[model samples]
Target: MDKGKNKWAVLVGCNYPNTKYTLHGCINDVQAMRDLLVKKFGFDPKNINLLTDKPGSFILPTGANIMKALNRIVDQAQSGDVLYFHYSGHGTLIDKPFLPFSKEEAIVPIDFNLITNVDFRHLVNKLPKGVTFTVLSDSCHSGGLIDKEKEQIGPSNNHLHGDSSISCSKPKAIPYESVLTHLSSLSNINTTDIGTHLLEVFGADASLRFRLPHVELEFYKALKQDEGILLSGCQADETSADVISEKGEAFGAFSNAVQQVFKENSGPLTNAEVVSIARKILANQQFEQHPCLYCSDENAAATFLPQSATAASSST
Candidate 1:
């Protein structure tokens, strides 16, 4: 961190407890990241915002709340500031008829409302020059979460398939059909249009990206911006795993791999370096998911977190 600048972070984890979508590792991921941001990266505890679905958590990771927090951070950020957002949860794809890809990626909040890639693009466009927002999304289908960004480490045909024999592991993905079924059940709307269901339930708070006309969505996708850096857990077509160890310890496989890389390296790791090391870690563990880095070539070579002298020395 530059002495003249400040660092802020928003760490979110959604373990949809008592529900069919429940997972055991997301909350743990958030806690570990919070510790890393404070002790290893020199972030003030007061500057980090935490949102989770764990019982008694004052702030829940609802879609509205998540967007609010992100907007607040972008609104307040100044030139040379360092910012980060880490998300550990289920990720899903939504149909986007106008786009060539045919779908858009989004992260699922605790209430099933989604925050889409277009939303992220809008956020990035608002960022001041010299300010960077680094995102680490440990979720399935997370590769392109920061829409239109350049790919540094992308999917390859040689990627290995996951080992099915690995016990106590679950993919952190909720299928589009399943999402529609759940939302229909909740809203009593029997249509297949996701936007309609979301509109019925969340109304004005629903993601505008979903409700926008196809022409507008196309226009938004065509606009380019470069202040966002994304380190996604896996390729858009792959699924990230949530694993439970023999001793009952649960964690996101990708998140654990990232932490392992940080522990094994002393000095600051570049955005590309961290994703590269994490990819190897996941491969050695027999996980099929391939971590990806998306940003400008310049950002790919930038430090994971701009660190103060004390923080850099302590890590060494």
Candidate 2:
């Protein structure tokens, strides 16, 4: 860790309780991550901000609130500082006819407000040099959450065969039509345009990528950056699993695999190494979802959470 530099993090988990989209393990995932950061990684408790949808949570994991927390962390970042954002929730894909891929990745906030990959690209472009912003998203279709980042590990045509024995698993994703229907009910706007529904509900707080013209969206996506690192739960076309263990504990499969990797390794591991190990763990456990790492080659080889000087020193 750089001496006197700070480490900041924003952890968000949305269970969407009491609704049709309820998830059982997202909150538990973030809580466990928070404990790991504080106990194992030497992150200060105060510097780690948490947003969840559980009853009486100080801050709800709404779209605007999530962005505010992220922006706050980035605004306070300085050279050599390490920043992290972890989100365990539902992810969705939006049709973007303007792009060659014909779709974009997004995370679903509690209020049906979706934050798109283009929005992440804009946020990442503002980072100060020497400040690393690493994001871990344990949600479905999260592979490309940070747009235009170099693909160190990505989708493949060959699917790894797994046991498929896990019986109580659910996909942590909401379809685009479902999101539009939910938003339409709230905004009283009946249309297929999700952008219109989001604009009506969130106004200026809505993601600009949704409302921007196709040309502007392309421009934002074209902006380049080296500061953003993403560890996704699954490939762009795959779904991450939320499993109910035999012990009745609920957690995201990818999140569980990550925790297992950390437990199995004592010394610091590189970003790519962590993802690679987690992918193998999931595959061995009969999961089809493949975790991915998105970053420059240099960052791929960089030590995971290297800014935690105390943890690094103590582990050695």
TM-score of each: 0.94, 0.93
Which pairs, if any, clash in model 1?
Answer: 1-306, 1-307, 1-308
Q: Which tens-of-lDDT digit does each residue in 1-316 have in candidate 2?
A: 3332778889999999999998999999999999878866778999999999989988799899999999998888889888989999999988774555577789999987898887788778778888888899999978788887888887766455565445588899999889878889989977777788889999988997877887777677635548789999999778998888777889999998989898888777889999999988898778888899999888898877763667656654
lDDT of 1 by residue, 67-165 (tens): 999999999999988889999999999997555558879999989998899888878888888899999999998887888999989986556544433
Instruction: Find the 10 residues in a row with the least total lDDT in model 2.
Output: 158-167
List the candidate 2 regions with Cα displacement exceeding 4 Å: 1-4, 97-101, 157-167, 222-225, 313-316
Candidate 1 — which residues are off by over 4 angstroms? 1-4, 99-101, 159-167, 222-225
Q: What is the lDDT for 1 in model 2? A: 31
Instruction: Report lDDT per candidate.
Output: 0.87, 0.85
Model 1 TM-score relative to the real fold:
0.94
